[model samples]
Target: GADVVHAHGLHAAARTALALSGRSVPLVMTWHTRRYAEGARRQILHLLERRAVRAAAVVLAPSSDLVDRARLRGARDARLAPAAAPSPRSSQAPHEGKVRAELGAVERPLLVAVGSLVPHHGFGTLLDAARVWRALDPVPLVVVAGEGRDRSALQQRIRDEELPVRLVGSRDDAGELIAAADLAVLPSRWEGRSLLAQEALRLGVPLVATEVGGVPELVGEAAELVPFGNGEALARAVVRLLGDPERCAWLAEAGREQAAGWPTEDDTIAHVLSVYDELAQPSPHPR
Candidate 1:
């Protein structure tokens, strides 16, 4: 009775219905991420992934890397359909004043990072960079705007090391915080085309982020890149950007231009609909 089955990942919940529903339906799977595993568990997952790829009518990946991986896993039709960020027009609200005031209205350089307090987010590296940033004559404020289980641990490190960093916990107005900053940073150890990076670029905020996952592809020449987990590199990138206002301005302008060319949510939906129209056609042979 179903026209098609749309799945979002290689996980059980995403693929189970397509694999076991015992019905003939066009299946579309969107590959968002892949997890690390080992031993028999890894083999099991690999096998399941192969089966899922074989069963899917089409696989949509957010980046070329994911599309390549899907094809390697035996997906019949894998295509690139990069994820879209919120339109810049909608995010133009000016809450920057309120956001800066909440952070003691700091007059010095302000760096913003927006992600949960997770280890893989590489926030510990940011803390180390903050220490380096603080040794300067006018210390900068590093504001992280997200919450997670590692909150206590990060807070403890800040207190013990006397680092110039503050965790603002979860924030609904994260775009405002990014807008209030002199720069944005994403020290992720791994990522799948970070939404934060997209948002930062779209908002015309210069960024210093780790060169991991699809970040290089996402930012193009619009931002500075640093190696993952290298606090020294992260700090140096920040210093370079902060010292050069002209370069920062160029990056901000370039980021906005690049982000403008990126596909929007409506584009993604239209692409999906196009695929559906193709797959929904009746075959020459009747079932």
Candidate 2:
């Protein structure tokens, strides 16, 4: 007999399992994020979310905000266990000079962002901030590396505005680029413990990210947090960090320290096992 069912998201497969089994076994559902494109699809997912939350034996959330959302949906047991990261490849520091050279021949302050070129990822806001930053004495080069359906539209905007932003399509060495950046910016509208945030902090890259979803939880004062969707705020934060070298160094050092304390893959596995153990215990009988 199966001991438990673990559902990652409110996808069709998870919905099917919930429908077919009706909570026959202990069910653990991890709510990464509730973000979805608005429409009939979003409505359907919200309904599924309610059903899944009610049926789950325990809901694991990466941040407390999501735990609250789960409880609102009628989840009886919701726990916070921030996502784990793979072990670092080596303790050696990243070579900033080499990585910077790889970015481009242009010698300008490099700001790197990596994510799908989608509306929710909020590349539009970043582009606007780039436009605003162009007046700086030494203009920065905003390099974005990713691919999505919004590629064509974003490209057109870049051309129309004549912004100092480059959409370099997709990149494999995104981590290297991030390590080389004068600043790592994530102006996402919504997020749930992003891997990019983790990578930036781990590499000791000074970060300026939007305060949305679990981003604050990940950065935890180690990086500058800006309000989401405000291009002016994003631009100001980036400009301030670039001008203050000492502040940037402090943020980078603090980021590395924060990243050091993150849970490892083994720790995540152990937490999952403990949850299973709790579920497997037999209940006491009443007389």
TM-score against native, each model: 0.89, 0.92
lDDT (0 to 1) per candidate: 0.85, 0.84
Give the Å error, residue 47, model 1: 4.9
Cα deviation of 178 in candidate 2 (Å)? Answer: 0.6
Where does the lowest 10-residue lDDT sum fall in candidate 1? 12-21
The TM-score leader among the candidates is 2
Residue runs of model 1 more than 4 Å from their true location after superposition: 12-14, 17-21, 37-48, 88-95, 284-287
Worst 10 residues of 2 by lDDT: 85-94
Task: Report the lDDT tens digits of candidate 1 across residue range 1-287.
Answer: 66766787887424655455676778888878766567999899888778777778898877777788889988899998857877555545667776777886467788899998878899999998988998875788889999998999999999999998989999887878888898999999877778789888887899999988778888999999999999999999999988999999999999999898888888888999888888888988996
Candidate 2: segments with Cα more than 4 A from true spot: 19-23, 90-95
lDDT of 2: 0.84
Q: What local lDDT score does residue 23 receive in model 2, on the 0 to 100 scale?
A: 49
